[model samples]
Target: MGQGPSVIDQATFKEMGLLSWAIIDLAINWGGWAVSAALQTDKFYDMLGTGSFLTLALGSMAAAKVSHARKYLVSAMVALWAVRLGAFLVARVWKVGHDSRFDEAKKQPFKFWIFWTMQAAWVFITLSPLLLLNTASAGGPARIVWSDGVGVALYAIGLIIEATADAQKFAFKMDPANKGRFIDTGLWSYSRFPNYFGEMTLWWGIFITCTSGLSGAQFVSVASPLFVMALLFFVSGIPLQDAQAKRRWGDIPEYQEYRKRTNLLVPVPKSLFCGASCGPKSQ
Candidate 1:
């Protein structure tokens, strides 16, 4: 298949306050990385996702002469999730180069600038919860308790499912024999977008961890996971991919049959009667 053509171009970054705020936030996040690396907390860093958490920890450690427990936990989770997502996107961008969808949106000069600026703003907005949550944790001593255990379990499960789903899709697409073929095996068979399901659930797990204290700052953390889930399921993730799928397979009877038998986001065991029973022509 031809690489999708760019529909937008000539976009430049705008000097907006929102953009400035986002940059400042990201810079603070970098500081977190510096201290985290120095402290040899690579595993913790990986789990937290963003440098922001580390930054929060560093700042907290400085003021209090000891780490605030809540800050440590929330920052760690935020950093882990952000890093995982950022790495995944970076890899994807490397493989495909500049995202065509983004390129297309940048075609009009004024619109291009706006789009680029919004991209920056979005980064800050989406991550604001983590940043806020981290600061909130710095206030006083907090205890890690049973809720923490539950949250950790949920996070672990979510990560496993999401990672497995992504791996399955990647492997399926890599095989030359599978070219132009729909995947209906492994995790793919379980849910149309198992990765997305896992993604939403993962954030909720993080949210659970952040909210264990039931503080006002913890309330702010709620937005991070909820916003991400909405963005993934509705605004950016599923809608875009589903549009492509419809474009590719809308007219195919086999796709229609598969659609009938499978859930969109939840995994269901493939029925023996449903699979072999579909005639060869449909396959």
Candidate 2:
């Protein structure tokens, strides 16, 4: 079937303005916390955090005067990613019974609320590009472009890499023989945080696809991937994990060696001949 032309008009724009979307998105985030706080469990946070993105994306699509196939495709991608991540995180937290990250925060109402607000901000920044594209009164059905293909390829690669790394790590943790040992095999051999690399790549790909539909003020949506990268690198993902790993295994010669040989965030093939003592000293 042929793709339809864009149908966004002045009336549609007025009805689904950026501010309205932001308010709705933030409301969903804050609302999720009510259930979490009432139950006194943070296990639901992941599901709600991810579900918010899908909710907002679908909401925007529904608000559009004429939804194009591109809109549907982008929305589907966001939903797919969100569902996978949400399910994985929810399963993880459920299995663990509690998230240590919230142990202290949950005890203080204000601190807990701040964390929920941060989740709201995270959802807003990470999905900014998709949000803009979905709500914009832009051109006709998205034509397949080189960037689209490249973006899709990057996204697929990222998803596979992330899933693989998570599976490998989970399996390693489950093995009694691997107890107290760091995972330095499979994708982990290439980077200390291969999964994070994948996560960042996924957002970058999504941002690229957003560029296909965005214009003018919407260009500011580039912040989507940029924010994801920043959060993963300096703020939440890498820094925390790195610190935890170091605290757990800093004295182990092997882990120190592994740290020296492995890239911090980018994947690269490990040298086959590196000795236990060959790499640089730990920082």
Candidate 3:
């Protein structure tokens, strides 16, 4: 949980550039890869990401010269997020025994290495705001502003949505009668992928929280949220999940109707007024 002070000062960290964060990511992920490849498993991949975020957050704060309430608050948030999500995902993977997503990749050493590398990139880009803020030089006594409150509110909303959605799905899956049926109740009725919606919201929330500490070009860390959104929308998150759903239930009218009416990833209230006319069709 604790790391010794960075050997390189903030200035030297700059000289070395993003590589400082890059090295941290590669070191942690590649080390994780070594173990995963040896075992021929990807079960621990998400946990590794959780560890990367915690390290960037708490470790950077420990190595920082500018200590403030913001740093403490941000670091704590990151740690809390890591522990909650990491425990959940790790438990799920262990329950499932293996991640189907890695069925082919785990067999190829070079491909498995690429998966870990991409995971490293996910941590790096996603946690950039925290890294920048934690490593910044002291900016003098600054009052925590209204933005802090907004950030925390957004984060709480996101955390609740994501956690609740996952819990609901898990509960649904545990019921034997529900076998072969898709979840169209609870939060799933509001959004096909409420959990992914929660994931995007929380990352954006963290970015907004870090914005108070940022200025000028440093604001480019906006990629933290944008990358999350893009990754979910254009890349792995939505596409893979959607494809899997179609493969399983594509021919069923009920499943097709569910997709036709449910907002793909955004949670919206379903009502006869909004659903059939505007939002997802109501149950």
lDDT: which candidate is best? 3
Off by over 4 Å in 1: 1-23, 26-66, 106-122, 137-141, 217-220, 270-283
lDDT of 1 by residue, 1-283 (tens): 2433332211111112233345555554444344544542322222223444334433433333234566566556655666666566556555544555544433444444443344444446555544444434243336677767787778777777887887787678778999988887877776688888877777677667656545653475577677877787887688998888889887999887777666677665545446775435553
- Candidate 2, residues 1-283: lDDT per residue as tens digits? 2333234454555478567877877788778777777777788778888888878878887776556766777777788888888888888888778888898777676787888889889988888887777776663346788877787888888888888888888888778999888999998988899999889888888888777787777778888888888898899788888899989999999998888788786776555445556555699
Ranking by TM-score: 3, 2, 1
RMSD of each: 13.5, 5.5, 4.2
Cα error, candidate 3, residue 91 (Å): 0.1
- In candidate 2, list every pair of residues with a backbone clash: 6-140
The window of 10 residues in a row where model 3 has the poorest summed lDDT is: 1-10
* Model 3 misplaced stretches (Cα beyond 4 Å): 1-18, 139-141, 270-276, 279-283
> Model 1 TM-score?
0.67
Q: What's model 3's lDDT at 75?
A: 80
